[model samples]
Target chain A: MKLVGIAGTIEDHSYNRTLLKFMANHFSDQVDIEVLDIQDVPLFNQSDDQTDGAPVQYLKRKIEGADGVILATPEHNHTTTAAMKSVLEWLSFKIHPLAGKPVMIVGASYFDQGSSRAQLNLRQILESPGVDANVFPGNEFLLGNVRDAFDDQNNLKDDKTISFLSSTLKKFLTFVTTINDMNAKVAAADWESEDLGAHGHVDTTIDGLDMHAADWVDQATKKTNAVSGDTYVRLDCGVLTVDQLNYFLNSMPMELTYVDANNQFLYYNHQTDPENMSAKRAPAQVGNPIEDCHPKRAIPHVKQAVHILRSGQTDLFKLPVPSDGSKADMHYYQAMHDKDGNYAGINEFVLDILPIVKYYLGLTGQKLVKDPNATDALTGASKKSDDAKPDDVSGASANTDEAPAEKPAEEPKPDVDSVSGASANN
Target chain B: MQKFIAMVGTNSTNSTNRKLLTYIQRHFADKAEIELMEIKDLPLFNKPEDRKVPAVVTEMANKIDAADGVIISTPEYDHSAPAALMNALEWLSFHITPFIDKPVMIVGASYGALGTSRAQEHLRQILDAPELRARIMPSSEYFLAHSLQAFDDDGNLVDEQNIKKLDGLFADFQIFVKISDQLKNAHGANYEEVRNLDWNK
Candidate 1:
């Protein structure tokens, strides 16, 4: 049996990572272990399938192929690590990759009990899902005083624990081998249908659930009770009309969150208008704490933008949120100024322009904004006006003061790569 | 009378899974004594020759030896079983075929989507060892989805759907364990009887 050791931790000096290294060396002659990194994994989001920006596809494949997995986890916020849980969230796309897999969990921590509570908490989260972990006869490896557990070479110091671990592997191997032998032909019965829910169509697969998108969307305040000046005013609820919704939805390049300054979430145009719900994949995020939805790594950048917008500056920040291996980048523009030129709190807009780019590339159909008079008939601002115009388009006369005040018949084409790169820099 | 050991793998200080398993043990509490194995203490797995057999390993082996049957309640991680729990399994595998001919039931729970189906599948694959007697529970029975929210503070299944699933799984597991124990004690003589199982139920 190939003994795959799962190492989770993006950092270089992670203690759990070190423990994985020790396991690698200890089982060098007997097993093959690989460290699976969660760094490249985008947050899982189901709606990403409908958007031009899609989530990663290969991460789930790795978990499916592993024999016995060993997880080296660190404790965070008094429980299992966030990155670790994030990986699990991604895995939830599948029916049950972890269900019957033989697993060995070992953790390292600076504190006493060796991050035991975190490990235990993680186990609870794992077991809650149906893994028959060979937990009995009490299988726990808590390396309290983690410093002592590792030697000068950064390997496990104790020899006895190693033997026990080896023994555990033997037992697990036997169990795995036995099970596989019994169910040897089980793979043949998998699917006869061509559309066997391929690509996470089945809720049990990785493609079905959008964990990254969920996390990103979840960061915002989902519950919004409008409080205007003192009285709780109720804005329109339920779906709007098809024509109005379609114009509002397709007119803007970005996913717009119309906030009336006090950081209160007001409205977001549903992607698929109610009338055309079949072809439409509405944005999963409706009313949520906008801040909570950002990537942890990108939180600081978002804060900086929020700060600038709050301080009366129309901060235009562009970032390439990781979309699978390639960048399905988006541009964020927040302006505190109101429609009346009065200072409102902020009008935040997030636009996934990958579709626009793909359209521009001739790889897809109509341009992102297909309106005949691309600009607003009233405001004279083009529908894609807020979208960052690459230098190729930016240098055009439309960006100049001398350009025609009347609506232009054609939108200036942009240098897709350059503009996307520019958007990602912030 | 032969004794059966129920090993519950959980990390929560007050785990709902543990509480559920505890309630099940109570049913057998008067009929038979049960050993509740605590895994929070085992040392990290390293080669014994390199690190020596830690006391925790020996204690774990002792519990396995004393029990006629072992029931493990595993936690799901990364759509699989927790590494900590797996590590324990690794330790047990290294010690002996503690799972050999030992009757086992795999049950799982989750707070979201399809329950712990992934973890349970992984566990089933592990338990498929020829030496291990896996009393496989049907997918519908073993899975308790949105389980975290189902249990109240007192560990009772507040939702009817979850309660029904849990009850069915527990009942099946009890039968599986009892039958498995009887077959194990009878050795190969009762192996034929144990093999004739209605796994679908």
Candidate 2:
């Protein structure tokens, strides 16, 4: 499980921060806990919205990607510090990354009360309609007289305290799973709201053009004065000409397609004839809404897949194609996110993994057989398997995770790259 | 006339709470010499080891000390008073005792129908803390709900009932201020007690 630790204090030295650091190091094996710094976050003033600012956006993206969040707070007055409150205000205002996200509160204090009042105050604030964070119940880890709580290397000296913290974290993880599962089930029916008509306009949605037009790609390229051929385009890590970019993408083994955040089918690697491709996508289908590109029967499934991806429920949705008992084709719908982790769109790719499986089996001298424990594995299934890193979903989008923040990450422009993750293909 | 400092809670450029305070200052002009102060300019409190307050905070404390009472007009954000106001209060109580034994009236305005009701309660608890120990007027709450529509073209409160309630509260606060001053037997002891507390030490 991945979690992010937010040390509520922006101070140079704080016991609260120390507590979080100790938790991160001690429980390093149990979870991926990245300690986020809040010093750069400006105070929340509705008059001055720094919501789109780098510091706040960084925290948002980090929290969005995390399975759960741990907030280590210090007491100021009888409540959480103003810095912590300010951060919460920013998170809740305009952008709600904490909404429906599971959060755990831990605190430390110089007094005997050990930030008791502050934690309660934090709970109240988090439960407000705007924040709406699912705070864990009944586990208050308050480190009192925190001055003597730690040793030379900042490790907690008390074994009893350490063991309690361990148990609390384990319980909190279980709570996180339960809450996420509940949210998925409850929100599953709400996916019908996904507007596949491309009615909503993004910044890149070209104006005064029919999205359903077969000549959309040609018209859009001309209207935008888009570069082509030897025109050099600067990428995140390298500079490549438009022709070079095409050559690289077209050489990819898997048939790839790009549907933008607005649900507009924008591009496909037209490497071969439509009949010869693994996924039969034509060049004329470019710039159509995803609804226009798929059959009526597939609309509901498409909407659900895109909805889960867009909502950050999961990063990637994969399903097996029911082929004529020959081709073991798999369709992967990977949710793309900007550097700030906003859902950009879907990077749908189809590839027959049979060749790779056969090659692996031949090299390893192993035979393909069903396990005795397997009850329903004869036909192609979703396979909710991220146990082993499924790194074989190859494409230019694999590099999108590392997209530079200097430019708009979700922009349909060639330089933009975004986030992607995996979910079972319900 | 009793002098009272009206502290506007939020740092937002446009706030109905500030409008409410402005209306109160003018509406109760003859009743009390109300001076408006903003918590916006004060820096966020980080609990410095030296325990020295900023110059702006000291200035605020001086004004509060000079005033006979304080009337805080607050706005709710995430079901609590804005952090800017909380930050100012933190600095005030960190080293100085501006609010100790001082008469305080908590009033709030909100765009929503709740009128910052929960936040006013929260502020009451904060002021009642040992570090603050403010003498808040009891059995009194004047929250202007749907405050956006409560004001008129001239910025006067449009509702006659709200005006009547505010007038009665202002009178009560004046009386409460005089009564609070007479109840200062433990003020000196409380100051010493607060000063000697094992804080940040």
Interface RMSD of each: 14.6, 1.2
- Model 2 interface RMSD, one decimal: 1.2
Per-residue lDDT for A94-142 in model 2, tens only?
A: 9998988999999999879989998999999999988999999998999
lDDT of each: 0.52, 0.84
In DockQ, how does model 2 score against the reference complex?
0.66
Each prediction's RMSD over C-alphas, in Å, is 20.3, 8.5
Q: Candidate 2: deviation at residue B118, Å? A: 1.1
Error of 1 at A309 (Å): 11
- lDDT of model 1, residue A150: 79
